[model samples]
Target: MKLLSRAFATAVAAGAAAALVSLTGTVGATAAGSGTAAAPALTQVADEAPGYAVEDFAYPDADRILAEQGIVLKRGDGHITLAACGSETGLLEVWARSKDKVCFRVSGNGGYLSLEIPSVYGVKGNAYATEVTMTVEDEEKSFDIAKNTWTPVGESADPNGRDHMLVEIRATR
Candidate 1:
């Protein structure tokens, strides 16, 4: 697949979208699903292959991505990551087809905070509704993924939110 930038969002593909996949940088946007004569449309972060991958990202910029403070990628999950980064969340969303959602937050002194995945969890190792570990007031707490872990953030103050949030690959196996 042909990796690209936001310019691809407006590029009128020349030939059949049979070779490379272009990127619009606009998730859920119109160009997120375009193809090129070079390769088929990007179906996911990586096609059905297995290999080592790495991606680095920074705060969003109008031009090419500048200096990045964070990086994310899949060390397992079966797919080899070519393009390794996107957006400011600093979480490398690894998937295709499905619109994935990832939430990141850190805690300094918490009441009730949330921990979410950037992609679908709980279905293998990458399910979006994965579990969250809460340590409040030096006390360990657990929230069921069914009710709370799915919510990116909470409204009420019954629990506290995250502080030094850093959303990256959960593990690098």
Candidate 2:
């Protein structure tokens, strides 16, 4: 009888230990499953730096050109770019200057540009059909520039020789 009682006690102890383990696990699972105030908050980081934005259309070498050439370049569609003067091939040369003429090389089928150059009364086009827009005081004029040749514009086209600013240029293949 003593042996049977000891065996029963051992079985009971084993069952009780198993129950305790199961209960502890159940409590942990229940706490996790509640899903209220159990998850930690996430901190988000910005993809880009603060106070920084990219300007895709801003002119290339703007600071240097503005400082050296005394001309202001604003924005464009990226098909045209400023080039050194006297480029032989594949260039749209603008021969307007207060002291010396400047030029730009244009590529691609067609493109547009916005710039600020005072006293640009004429331009020499390349292989592409070109057009230019100018503003004199409050009057705006659009000129259909000749291809591969110099065409008179602004004050050159105007009998009064009124000064004009070249504002835009468009070229097509």
Candidate 3:
């Protein structure tokens, strides 16, 4: 009986912890602050090719986390932006990007929107431009220029879908 009670309490605590985490946001990279880097730009002697031009990715269902706002992708100065669609069906949604850091990502709040009721969320957590987008929501905000492992997840259920995800940008690689 005591063990059972302990187990029940443990489950309740876990549920509460998960609730708290969801109340905040999922684990993903976030824009720290507007403040620029404190240290001076380090000089690199090696000459690397043009990095992160237009690219395509197969985002998994796990990375398909919801976007309260949408996802943004860019390479070099130019970029491409994709918004999340509300409906389950997918469609190609595209947008141009500004010049800054090539191969970078940014994500909108999810738990902030998910925590509220649908109607309340519809009013407060309202999702925009979710109907037409073919791409999935970007779940990976942690971009690595060196590893090239930072692939933001936008969802596409259609396995046979072609050109479902298209990213057009000028990269140094």
True-structure RMSD, every candidate: 24.8, 12.2, 28.3
Q: How do the residues 1-173 of candidate 1 rate in per-residue lDDT, one tens digit apiece?
A: 24565447446453223223235333233443533224347658766689767543322331232223122321223221223344333232322112233333212221222222222222112222333433434444333333222233221212444322212222221
lDDT of each: 0.30, 0.81, 0.29
Candidate 1 lDDT: 0.30
Which sequence of candidate numbers ranks them by lDDT, best first?
2, 1, 3
lDDT of 2 by residue, 1-173 (tens): 99999999999999976775576654223444542333557877887779968778988888898999887888998887888876557677665657357787788788888998888877888888888999998999999988888899888898899988998999999
lDDT score, residue 83, model 3? 30
Best by TM-score: 2
For candidate 3, report its TM-score: 0.16
What is the alpha-carbon lDDT of model 3 when measured against the actual structure? Answer: 0.29
Indicate the residue-level lDDT of 162 in model 1. Answer: 33
TM-scores vs. true structure, each candidate? 0.21, 0.67, 0.16
Off by over 4 Å in 2: 1-56, 97-99
Off by over 4 Å in 3: 26-173
